[model samples]
Structure formats: C-alpha cells, structure tokens
Target: MEWWGVLEGLLLVLVLAALPLVLFALRRRWLARSGSLVECSLRISTRSSRSGTPGAGWALGVARYSGDELQWFRVFSLAFRPRLRVTRRGTTVLQTRPPEAAEVPMLYRDQRIVVLADSEGRQIDLAMETSSITGLLSWLEAAPPETRYPV
Candidate 1:
C-alpha cells in the first residue's frame, strides 16, 4: 500500500472512533440547553463484604425538573428518557454537603451534593450548585397540597 493509503486508513479509523464521542457530546449539549439540565453526580453506594463499609460510586448525569418530577439522564447515554425520576409529592431532602475530598474530584466544579429520601425509603444523591439546590427545594415545596396527601 502507498503512504497516502496508509494515512487515509488511519484517518478513517480515527474518525470512526471519534464519531460516537462527538455525537454524545452534541446530544448532551442539546439536552442541557433545551432541557435546562443541571450537572450532577448520582451516587451508587455499595457494601463491602469484609468490613461491610459502604462505598460510594458517583456517576455524572444531568437533571431537569419536568412538571412535578425531577428527571435524571446519564451524561453518556443515548436514551431519550431519564434513567431515574423523583417526584415532588413524597420526596424529602435528608441532607446537603460539599463534596468530600475524594468526591470533589468526581463531581463537577462548584457543585453541592444533596441526599434525598423518597417515601419508599430509597435514597438518592444529587449534586448541583447551591442555587440549583434552592430551586429544587422550592420546586419540591411548591407541590400541590392534594398531591402531598394523595387519596
């Protein structure tokens, strides 16, 4: 094969590899601008066998408030629907804290992580800015009175 052919082959390989990444980024940007996505970390806590210590794994995702629900979509996923949804009716904010030294590196810049529990006792960790947290709290608090005590 000629030198130009080899270069062309390499170029094609690079483009094929990078195409998915470019598409993913474009999709995320579109979601952010159009859907008002808030960058966040979703914690996946695990239990260790030996010591039984809880370990946390954070996945970067974007969240948006849709009507009375908060929808979370993974940053790298191609799905159109959110992977997790939290409704305003029976959700409670358990705590809020700055990212730990270990978690800071995993979280986005200037994001605060908040722990929330649903009525079913399931815990979800959401990371966002202080302003976003305030907005979330407001949204949760603004749920209709009837929804708070469903018939």
Candidate 2:
C-alpha cells in the first residue's frame, strides 16, 4: 500500500478507539451528575423540617423499594451498620401489618430522610429534615466498632 494510504488507515483506527473512550467518559459523567442530584434532593428534604430540641436532630435515612414485594434499607448513620427489611404488603403499613421479616426497628424520629426507589435504580421520592450534623457525628463516633467500616 502507498505510504499515505497506510497513514490514513492508522489515523482512522486511532479515531475509532478514541470515540469509544469519549462516549464512555460522557456516560460516566452523566451517571455521576444524576447521583449528585439524587443526593441533593435528599439533603433538601431534611433541611426544611423542624429540627426539634435546639438543633439536636440528626439526619438518618431509610429506603423502601416497590414492586411485587416490599423491601427496605435503613441507614441511621453513615458510619454505622445498615438494616435491611423485606415485606409483602409494604413499609407504610408497618403498624397495621408488621413486616414478614423484621431486622431492626427504624425509628420515625431518627429517620430524618426517607426515599423510595424502584428496582431499576430510579428514585421515586425523598424526604429530609434538618439534622444536627454534629449530633450525627457524635453518634457515629460512639457507634459499635463492628458497625464501622475501615478505610
């Protein structure tokens, strides 16, 4: 093949390889942005609630899943253990119809934030209340060693 033609082919191959890398980076950026928005929504929900006890409130989260059956994940503190719950009816009627499998009691007061999502990873809704960021830190510090994850 002519020198110019060979160079042209090499250029084309390089462009094809770079194209995929560019597309992958764009997808990652998009997913990251969406995750950030979800996190922001959770933070805002708690920001407006009545942070009772002179800012003694803390932000804890509970996530409920929808579809054929009810499922949930509760995280009281980022540094502590996570509780998972699964039910047939749903979490909303926990009092009327208790969960089929009980893990840990999720306190309404501690749950400053609640989120609902589908299996596809789409967030359905979220709720948040002003949390004493300081209190959460203290609770996390005192949390059991087994509950914490080492960096």
Candidate 3:
C-alpha cells in the first residue's frame, strides 16, 4: 500500500514537469490552425543605433499575417501575444540572399534569407523557404493602391 502511494507521487511529479511542454505544443498547434503560418528564422539587424553588432542571435518563430500586419511569435514561448509586428504598408524588402554556410546549420535547409527595412528604418532579417518567399513578396505587394505612392 505504501509503494502504491509512492508510485502515485512520482507520477504526479512527472506530469507537473511535462505540463509546460504540453501546453507549448498545444499553443503552437492552435496558432498554426488558426491562420497562415510561415516557419522562419528572425534576427534583428546589426545596424541599429544602439549597437554596431547584432543583438544575441537568431530566433526561430512562426510569422502569421493578421490583416495588414505581420506578427511574429517565438516557437518556444508560452506567451499568447506576438513579440514583433510589422505593417504591410511600412515594410520594404531591402535585399535577399542565401544563408551562409555557418548560418545554414541554424536555419532550415535550402531556405533563403531576406533583409527588410520598416518605415522606422529598423532592419529585420527573415529566413524562410523559397515558396514562402514568393508568398511574402505577394503579400507585401498586395497593399491597397491608395497606400502606395511613387518612391
């Protein structure tokens, strides 16, 4: 009888330890099913005024288009809100290039990276698959005609 109690206690501890991971998986699934999600690697540009070097490193996240804005949420996070949001009207693709060999291990295989500048002049790097690049370009170009003016 005492052994049974010990077994129950051990099981409870295991469940408690695994609860966060289970919740995170559920959140990720819900996000994916709720909208268009693109798997991407993101890094804040190193050219910011605060620092000459990049901050920390890349983060793996899912980018979802919510109306006219793109929301980025980290994959491993438990938070329900996006960490970054970029409006379509203010986003510009500054450049696109294949990942370097060192970066290849950090990103999805065969995915290309794009450098984008927002209206605030902040640079953001996004790495995604080739097909996703096409989708992203189409989304960026699909801004309402009234929102676009001659550069």
Candidate 4:
C-alpha cells in the first residue's frame, strides 16, 4: 500500500473515535442550556444494578430541580431521561460532611457530601458545591405547605 493510503486510513480511525466524544460534549451543553443544570455526584445504597458494582459508589451526574422532584442524569450517558428522581416531600438532609481525603481526587475543592434519607428510610447521597447546599435545602423546605419537610 502507498504511504498516502496508510495516512488516510489512520486519519479515518482517529476521526471515528473522536466523533462520539464530540457528540457527548454537545449533548451536555444542550442539557445545561435547557434547564437549571448542576454538576453533582450521586451515590445510592448498596443494590445490584447493571451500570456499576453492587456496592454503592459515587457516580458523576447532573441534577435539576423540577417541581417537587430532583432529577439526576448521568454525565456520561446519552439517555434522555433521569437516572434517579427524589421527591422534595419527606426528603431529609440527614448530614453533610467535607469530602474525605481519599475522595478529594474525585471531587472539586468547593464540593461537600450531603446525605439524605427519604420517607421510606432509604438513603441517598449527593455531592455538590458548598454554595449549592443552601439552595438544595431551601428547595426541600419550599415544598407544599402540607408537606412540612425539614433539612
């Protein structure tokens, strides 16, 4: 084969590999422009699932408040629907702590971990910027007057 043919083949492979990444970035940007998107990390309790291990671990995602539910979507996924949704009613902020020494590499400097418990006694963890905690708390607090959820 000629040198030009080899070069052309290599170029085609590189462009094909990069096409998905470019589309992923474009999709993320579109999500940001469509709503009040936030950079968040989510961890649910130990449960068997297809996406990851049976044990719970932090997965990077974006969250947006919609009515009474906080919709979370995986950053790496191209899915149109949320991966998880937690309602404001009975959503309690159990505790919040700074990221651990081991977690520092995975999280932003201003981010902290917030633990929440739903009314059904299931636990959900969220990591978000320090500035966004108050906003999240307020969203939980601003539920319908009859709900009366506390942070």
Task: List lDDT for all candidates, in order.
Answer: 0.79, 0.34, 0.83, 0.82
Instruction: Answer with 2 or 3, whichever has the higher lDDT.
Output: 3
C-alpha lDDT (0 to 100) for residue 21 of candidate 2:
73
Query: Which runs of model 3 end up more than 4 angstroms from their true locations?
Result: 49-56, 149-151
lDDT of 4: 0.82
Error of model 4, residue 18, in angstroms: 1.6
**lDDT tens digits, residue span 1-151, model 1:** 5999999999999999999998898788777776688877787332232222223467888899888789999987887778888888788787888877777777789998888877666778788989999988888878887656321
Least well predicted 10-residue stretch by lDDT in candidate 4: 46-55
TM-score-superior candidate, 3 or 4: 3
Q: For candidate 4, lDDT tens digit of each residue in 66-129?
A: 8889999999898778999999888888899887776666665578899898876668879999
Per residue, candidate 2 scores C-alpha lDDT tens digits across 1-151 of 5999999999999999898677656654544443321121121113345333422322234433233232222332322222332232221210111111221132233323333332333332223233532332233344355443222
Q: Quick one: best lDDT, which candidate? A: 3
User: TM per model?
Assistant: 0.78, 0.26, 0.88, 0.80
Candidate 1 local accuracy as lDDT? 0.79
Clashing pairs in 4: none
120 in model 2: Cα distance from truth in Å?
Answer: 12
Cα error, candidate 4, residue 43 (Å): 1.0
Candidate order (TM-score): 3, 4, 1, 2
Regions of candidate 1 where Cα sits further than 4 Å from its true position: 1-8, 44-55, 149-151
Candidate 2 lDDT for residue 98: 18
